[model samples]
Target: MKRRHFIAAAIAAASLSGAYPALAETDQVRVGYIADFWGASATAVATEQGLWEKHGLDADTKVFTNGPLQIQALGTNSLDFGYIGPGALWLPASDKARVVAISSVGNSDRILAREGVTSLADLKGKKVAVPEGTSGDMLLGLALEAAGMSRDDLEIVTADPATVVSAFASGQVDGAAIWYPFVDVIRKANPGIVELAKNADFPQNQFPAAFVTNPATVTDRPELVGKFIAVMKEAGDWRHANPAETIKITADFLGVDAAVLEQEATMGTSFTAEDLAAKSKDGTINSWLDGMAAIYVKQGKLEKALPAADYYTADLFVK
Candidate 1:
């Protein structure tokens, strides 16, 4: 069956049985998201634009400090859906949770450092703040490796992305592995800080951001998942059309200045279902998963290697 048709039929069947009611019938469909850059803004736009409600889902968004906690909520089924980095999905998928890539949020990573530090080698003995076990941390490790250094070469600290800005300014950490908007904020406060790396420098540009759900939910509530994807696509289309407006909404939602949000938005790449499907079929996303799996295995985080492609289902995105 065509993907869209199947989703529509599933939604119709569920609605008739009073299984998944409209948002008005319930408080909201809980969604967990990280508070970095476009993460929270995309969710806000989906809610503000009424996409979730239009698809028979409510907009109940919970802010998570990092991916591990977000994945934890999805595993417990506390959240109907959530966004996470590709690397974080492996651990949960091993535990039987089914995650799907609904769409791309954005790509805006940077390795920021204080003045006088022009390169990774200059980071020796310096404290760097990164959310441990996150894709950002993985990216940092890759950047370090490229510099012929390893995590053992520096002091890595784990902290919230928001706090990292203050941490950098207050000398809590010498450098931070963060994304845009926050990078903008950090630079503004410490004008001499330098950004040493970004996604373009990474292999295969291997950052995959996704919206995922539990296997039980996908199996039992396929229609709901499809509708959710449609809603996300709607938000993505809106974001593409109104870049300025989207930035304003995101900045207001995040309580950051509009200019910082604008800078971050400009650097972000928004993808629709079709774009994601193309990447999936072409092994673009598979390569990223494979790379992450290899990293985790080498770090002793995973005992067995995973078939990277098996961690995601692209059928949901194909119509």
Candidate 2:
């Protein structure tokens, strides 16, 4: 009854707010994502452009500050879909959410520091900020490892991405390893900060950003899943064919400067429907997920080794 009320309220609120317009009656869907981040720009694009409605889904997005929170919401059946870094899925080791497709890919990571801080070695005993359960948290550990240090050497503070910039600016944290457009906030304030490491530097993680859905949705409503994929493909097509428009839409949505967005939002190799189908069939994406799950274990985020197959299934992607 509570879930039904929530969905009904979402539908009424979404319709009343004039956020989107759809053709007719359909199933209401709740999508989750981190606020002001363009890693899932396709979802943003599709939501804004009314593509979900065109495909017969009355979609309303729930904003989470990080991926793990959204993943937790999935366990409670609060969200039908989520756009998040693949790491959060591995942390819980629960078979609640399933990755249906790669929505979009963008690399936005840098170990940002002020003028005086030279390297990770210099950050020993110094405070650094990162949002937990996102790429920043994962890469911060990796960056420290590369610098021959660990989180023990530095005061790793968990701050919301929204406040991390203020924390750095006020000397609360010596530095931060966070994703853009938040990185742009740091850069705009302190132009002298440099990247201690980048996403390209960590070749092992694959840095996959994906669209995950409630498992029951896939089993009970196969055609709806196919329609959702159609929306993803349409959004992807629009992104490639309209780069300038995409940047504008994304920047407007994120409330960041288009110039800053252009610098950090590099859409790496994206997945087409056919590519997702083929890769799922060949166990290629699964290989990356399995490796990522192992990484979570090594990072001590998970208690035991959990297979990627348990974390997510490619059945929806393949079918």
Candidate 3:
């Protein structure tokens, strides 16, 4: 099945059932993540392989269209644990949510331009599609600024992640700033697409997708949070050990092409126990969260930049 078909069926099922069927033997935890984002595959992997069951959790998963929506649900206690892109870091910095784990870090966000657009400056006055409050949106701003241009220089058409790919492919927009596997899809379909910039282009910025929960969840259910983190690590390590099988599993679960997933399979950070211990002990992951918070501060979305320790805790992972 294609991703769109799967999304439609999932939505219909969710509407009719109101929730995933829960097992009576395990504790229920509501999990959320941006749809199609490979960084959030840990949850999907856990669910697919019954890692949640192994860890004594019956996780009910929800697919969000973007990071901010997931953050909103987290704020309302609708999502117990979920993934948030760098753009939504302000929510956690402002106490709307709390970061518990660093899922992946790399240059997954890209500004893809159609043929004849050789530079970021070429995008001026051209329609560019991108979803607001996403890592793609943040990367777009950085790319524009690097070219000494502003959003006013181009026509910014707000579109969802899935919509951007279709619009870009049909020539509805001249350019699109989006993340993989959409970027991969667009490039594969349209050979003329030029990568204007990616998160990696700005070496100063670290693009990390974080696993987060509301502050209340952290305070009230510490053990549950710990178990969730443990399962995430288990899933992550499994992906590291089984790259080809991981691609097949993710393709089956997400309904994306296995080929596309294979090309970007290494995008998700797979940390071993030693890697986690070393990074957590040295506060490397916390610094990445703080860096994202700083971007929110500069954008005026946050009143003040909080220390990563203020909005994030590695205690659950380190314990």
Q: How do the predictions measure up, each by TM-score?
A: 0.83, 0.84, 0.88
- Across residues 214-244, which tens digit of lDDT does each residue of candidate 2 receive? 7777788777777677677677666666767
User: Cα miss at 38, model 3 (Å)?
Assistant: 2.2
What is candidate 3's lDDT per residue for 1-319, written digit by digit as tens? Answer: 1223333232232221111232334678988866553654676677787888877798888777777888888777788888887777777877888888777676678898988889988888999998998888888888887888888999999977767877887778999988877777677568878988888787787777778888888899887887788777777777666767777777667665577566556655566645775787798887787888887776667788778887777767777
Q: Sort by TM-score, best first: what order? A: 3, 2, 1
Relative to the true structure, how large is the alpha-carbon lDDT of every model?
0.68, 0.69, 0.75
lDDT of candidate 1 over 115-216, digit per residue (tens) = 988899998998999867676676787788788888888998887666676778777889898776667667767888888888778655456677777878
lDDT score at residue 168, model 3, on the 0-100 scale? 80
What residue pairs are clashing in model 1? none
Runs in model 3 deviating more than 4 A are 1-25
Clashes per model (N, Cα, C within 3 A):
0, 0, 0
The TM-score leader among the candidates is 3
